[model samples]
Target: MMKESVQADASALDGPALFATMSSMRAMRRLKPDAVPDETLEQLIQAAVWGPSGGNMQCYEYVVVTDRDMMARLAPLWKRCVDSYLATTGKYAPAGMDEAAYGRMVAAIEYQRDHFAETPALIIPCYRFPEPRIDEEGLIASAQALGPAGTEHLMNTQTRFQALAEGSCVYPGVQNLLLAARGLGLAANITIWHLMLEQEWKETLGIPEDMRTFAAVPVGWPQGNFGPVRRRPVADVIHRDRW
Candidate 1:
C-alpha cells in the first residue's frame, strides 16, 4: 500500500484537539474488517516518527502487514499466545480494579485473539537496537542489606526503571500513532501476547533475530464508538515536587 502524506497546520498538530484525541484513544479490540486507508496509515506513521528517541537515535522498525494470507498464518499463533498469557497472568487483577472489570478485560483480549486474522493492518513495532535482559545478579537482595520487603521493592523499582528506559525509545512512537489514529477516527489495538511464538513469527516474517518486536498494533475502522474515557483526577496522579 502506498502511504500518503497529510498536511496539517502547526497549531492543530499540538493544540488541545490533540489532547482530546490522546485522551479518547482507547484500546480498540473488536475492530471491523474494513481496511484503514493508506493515507491515514501513512499519516499515523509520520506522526509516530515525530516522537522523541533516546539520544535522538531512533533505531526502530515497523512491519505493516496487510496481506490476508499472512494474517491467517499469524492468527492461530496469536490465539495460542493469548491462551498462555491469560492462563498465567490474566487472573491477577491490578490494584483498585474489581473482578467484573478484570473479566471484561479478559473478554476484550479474547476478542482480538479470535479475530486478529481478520484485521486490516497488523503493524509490528520493533526495536532495531538490542533487547534488554534481566540478569539475576542485577536484582537487589533485601535480607543482605535491608529488612522486610526492601529487597522486593528495590527489585521492582529496578525492573520498572530499566524497562522504562528501554520502552521510552519505542513507546513514544506507539503513543503518537495511537493519538494520530484516534484523531482520524481509526481504531487500533496494541497486542504483544504473540511473543510466545516470537521465534516462529520472526522466522516466518524474516525479521532479524537481534531486533526486538515490542508490539503488534492492528489498525482498522471500529466496530465500536469513540470514547470519553475514564481516568483519575490530575491531582491524584501528579506530584508537584515529590511523590
Candidate 2:
C-alpha cells in the first residue's frame, strides 16, 4: 500500500517540475554508504507499482537487500560480471565520447564494483510470465497460419520475443522507481550485471526458480551531483510521421 505522506509528496509535483526531476536524473554510480530509511525505500516501491504492466497482471516483485552480509556474499559475483563486461563489450569508449570522459565513467563503474558490498540498499526487480494459454488446436492453427517462413521466425525468436514482452512491462516500473528516487533526493541507477550470473544471483537472493530478474539497482545518497543528461539534439533523432 502507498503511504499517505509519500503519495501526497509525489503527487504535489507540478508537470514542469516533474519533467525537471527527470531531466536531471543521472545514473549515479558513485554512491555514499549512508543508510536510506525503510519508509523512503517503501515510497520508491510504491511509486514503482503505480506503473502499468501488460494486462494489468502486475506480476513484478522486488527483492530489497540492505544486509551487509548479503551484499558481501554477492560482491564476488558482481566482480566477475563487471570484469567480463570490461574485457569485452565495455573495453573502450564509444565514438563521440572523449577518452577523459570515458575514463571517468569507467572509474565510476569500477568504484561501484569495488564498493558494491557497502551499498545502502539494492533492489532486484523480478517477474515470471504466466504460462501461455494457447490450446493445442489453437497453437496448431496459429502455426499453420504462419506458414514456413513465419513459423521459422517464431521458432527462432520466441525467447527474444518473450524477453522483449516481459521487459516492456517491468522497465516502466523500474523507470518509475528511478524517477521517484530522483524526486526524493536519493540516488539510484539501474544495472543489469546480475544477468551475467543470474542463476547464482537468484539462488543467493532466494528468488523463485521460475522468476526472471531484470535489473540490479543500487540506491543511496550520491557521492556526486545530478544534472542534465547529455543526448543528441531532438531534430537529429526525431522523425515526424515517417522515417
Candidate 3:
C-alpha cells in the first residue's frame, strides 16, 4: 500500500505536475519477460535527450543491448559482484536482519543474476570527454566573481565541484529515461554493477575508447505489484533557506 505521507504528497500536488510524476521514482526489481517494443524504447530515449547537459555539450550516448548471447556472457560477472557486495555489507548476516528481508534480498539478487538476459532490454549510458584538461578560463571567471580568498577555496575543491556538476547533468537524463519508461507502463532499474566488468563490457559493447560508461539500465514490464519505497521523513531532509 502507498504510505499516508506519499498519498498526501500526491494529493497536495497539482494534477499533471512534475512532482506528481516524479513521485513514482521507486526502484523496480521484478520485471516480466515481455520485451519492450523498439519504438517505445526509442521514444523514451528521445525524451531523455531533452534533459539538460553541461555547457550544452550533450556528451552523452546510450547503447541498447537485446542480444541474449551478450547478456549470457555478462551475467556471471554481475553475479560475482553482487555476491561480493552482499557479503561485504553483511546482507547475508543473520545478526539483526529479519528472515523475510534477508531472504528477499537473496532471492532478488539470484533472480537478477539468473534472468538478466530475459530483461527484454538494457541501456548503457556513456559519456565522452574531448580531453582531460582544467578549464582555466572558467576558473578565472569564477575567481574574479568571488574574489581571491573565495576563489582559492573554490579552486581547492574544483575537481569535486566539476564532477558533481557533470553528474547532475547526466543523471537527470537517466531519470527522464526511467520516467518515460514508467509512463509507458514499463519497469526499469539503473545499475552501476556493470562498472565491475567495465573492460569486458567496453570491448563487447563496442564502446568507443574515448567514451566511458556511466550506468546500465534494465527495462521491462512489471512482474508483480510495485512496492512502496522506503525513505527518510521529508522533515529530516527539507529545511528553510537558512539551513
Which number leads on TM-score?
Answer: 2
Cand. 2 Cα-lDDT: 0.88
Candidate 3's residue-wise lDDT over 1-243, tens digit each? 222233235452566755555666566667787777889999888978998888778999999887788877776777776677676763554554456756885787678767876778889888774454659897677778999998788869978986677687678899889888877778888878778778878988889887888888888888865444444457766788978
Q: What is the lDDT of candidate 3?
A: 0.75
Error of 2 at 188 (Å): 1.1
Least accurate 10 contiguous residues by lDDT in model 3: 1-10
Give the per-residue lDDT of model 1 (tens digit) for 1-243: 212222233343366776667656678888889887777788988888899888787888888888899999988888888888888877577666566766886888888888888999988888865555546654444255666577668666976875677689889999888888888888887777768789988887889988878888888888889765555545555788887
Q: Give the TM-score of candidate 2.
A: 0.88
- lDDT (C-alpha, whole model) for all candidates: 0.78, 0.88, 0.75
Give candidate 3 misplaced runs (Cα > 4 Å).
1-14, 17-20, 90-106, 131-142
List model 2 lDDT by residue over 101-204, tens digit each: 67988999999999999999999999988987889999789989999889899989999999998999899999999999999999998989879999999999
Score every model by TM-score.
0.77, 0.88, 0.81
What are the RMSD figures for all models against the true structure? Answer: 9.3, 7.4, 4.1
The C-alpha stretches of model 1 lying farther than 4 A from their native spots are 1-15, 130-164
Better of 1 and 2 by TM-score: 2
Clashing pairs in 2: none
